[model samples]
Target: MVEIKEIEKSFGRLNVLKGVSVSIPSGKVVAVLGPNGSGKTTLIKCILGLVIPDSGNIIIGNDNVKNSWSYRKNIGYLPQIARFPENLTVNELFRMIQDLRKGYANIAEAERCKEELVSVFNIQSFLNKHLRSLSGGTRQKVNVILSLMFDPDLFIFDEPTVGLDPISCVRFKENILKQKEKGKTIVLTTHILSEVDEMADEIIFLLEGKIYYKGSPDELKLQQQEATLERAIARLLEKNDNKINNQLPGKNN
Candidate 1:
């Protein structure tokens, strides 16, 4: 597990996180749903300490993030924007990241794992090619391979399936499920509603820098009188926003 309590973050005049709070249990896949400017990415950044929160706390496995920033070394993150120095062949990049990971965990066997993953993901064909020569989908595979390189305890991914082909997307989800079976916790955000319904054990709907709802997909659908998770989410947010508007200072409740 992980716990976030009333965490707030602001960038100048823009308040990205307005007292956001979420708790995720171990071995679960939690999906975050949101539209543009909804603070979903900001919340993830706060969790990773990439963006400092204005207040509140993030605790993971009994360790306070503020107290021990090193706790993050145990987590694997696949950021939305992945950048790498071009001209380096895929093999070289793998070696470099594996080397950097050694300093983080002092793992003596990381290179072995990296090679195995490269072959498993069918990335070997692209390994000798320079990064700039690969397609976007191939680059995405590389990004995912790198994030899962260490097989860290907690995996945080943003739009992980973007630019991937159908087969690759399915393979990626299968890998995530394998990680889930290993009792690893995962948090990710995606625009693909069907994938969220398929892979998520729980859902957190974020809107305007707040958690609109958090629960199982089944519970959400039945409550919202919808058969699909997508419709259910739309109903829930619409209902909540209607209530908010109804209670506005000059409006009738």
Candidate 2:
């Protein structure tokens, strides 16, 4: 559904994404895994057209994201931190989003989806509360509801489960599975390995702005000689460290 071709981006002298390339097929759940400063967020932003790459192309379906804004209507993005107008009540905020997306989304379906999401996340009562009055978990639930209400073709969730309670977390995962079952393409970024194991069909592991590993979770575990996804990732990092150390000057002196 999305193809990134030899993308490179740098901020001042600090390079972020260097020649990164990957294709995410439709109906697949791909997990973007990386430690801090690994360019995961930057890569996602590039795809969203929020951060322009120095040189490269991002293709969403047949449309190139360059100088485009319409394609974003088909994307449901839930950022790690969503800031809403504090004065708006939850219901009012949802209504405002619906108004903003009136032409892009089917109003009837959006309303039905919002109802279902509010129920699933159990945020019906919080709907009447102001955004500033809700707790972090409540606000997170609202964010999830808003993202899924439109049933977009592509879903980009960055640390989506953060601030969600255990029950809400499980519900969120279940909702993601339901979306996958409907043949939607999903791009997920999270530090939670167990969540990746459960929902991801493919893994894109990045290190220092490059794709260090890309494959199925089980394949990664086998290649890294580890029993769990967490351990496998650790082994992969160790290999990177070893490779870097081996290249240092005067290493054998």
Candidate 3:
């Protein structure tokens, strides 16, 4: 579904992504796991064309993402932080997005999907309320609904369960699984290892703007000789840290 080849990005003195490359197959849930400053979000932005990479190719389906905007129409994106017009009511916000994407495949189907998502996320009671007045979890629910309403082919969720309540988080997982079952590609970035263990078909572990490990969760645990997904990732990071320290200037091997 997506292919990233030798992607590189920098911000003045800081190199964010260094020749990162990964291929995401269709109908799979891939978790992009990393610590802070690992360039997970940067990679996602590159794929979405929100941030252009300094070099490399991001090909979704068959088209390169550079200087392209139309590929986004087939991709549903839920940002890590959703910032909307504070004064707009939930209903109004929904209407605005529906209007903006009026060219979606089927108008009636999109509306029906929106209504279904509203009910599933249990946001009906707050539809009339302004976005600024909603709780973080509630707002996140609205964000999820808006992203899923159009039923895009690929779903990209960044920190999707951040503020969700336990039940809501469960519902969100169920919905994502349903989408996967229907053969939709999913790419998620989150710090929650347990969620990754539960939902991810493959894990792409990133560190210092590079893919440190990419495989199934079980394979990672076994490879690292760790008992749990969290421990496995921690061990990987520690090993990388030691390796880097050993290679530092004036350091003895």
Best by lDDT: 2
Error of model 3, residue 88, in angstroms: 1.4
2 or 3: which has the higher TM-score?
2
Error of 2 at 197 (Å): 0.7
Quote the lDDT for 162 in model 3. 96
Worst 10 residues of 1 by lDDT: 105-114
Q: Which regions of candidate 2 fall more than 4 Å away from where they truly are?
A: none
Number of backbone-clashing residue pairs for each candidate, in the order shown: 0, 0, 0
Backbone clash pairs for candidate 3 read: none
User: Best by TM-score, which number?
Assistant: 2
Residues 55-116 of candidate 2 have per-residue lDDT tens digits of 99999988899999999999999888978999999999999999999999998999999998
lDDT winner, 2 or 3: 2
Score each candidate by Cα lDDT: 0.87, 0.94, 0.93
Q: Estimate each model's TM-score.
A: 0.91, 0.97, 0.96
**Candidate 1: stretches off by over 4 Å:** 103-109, 244-253
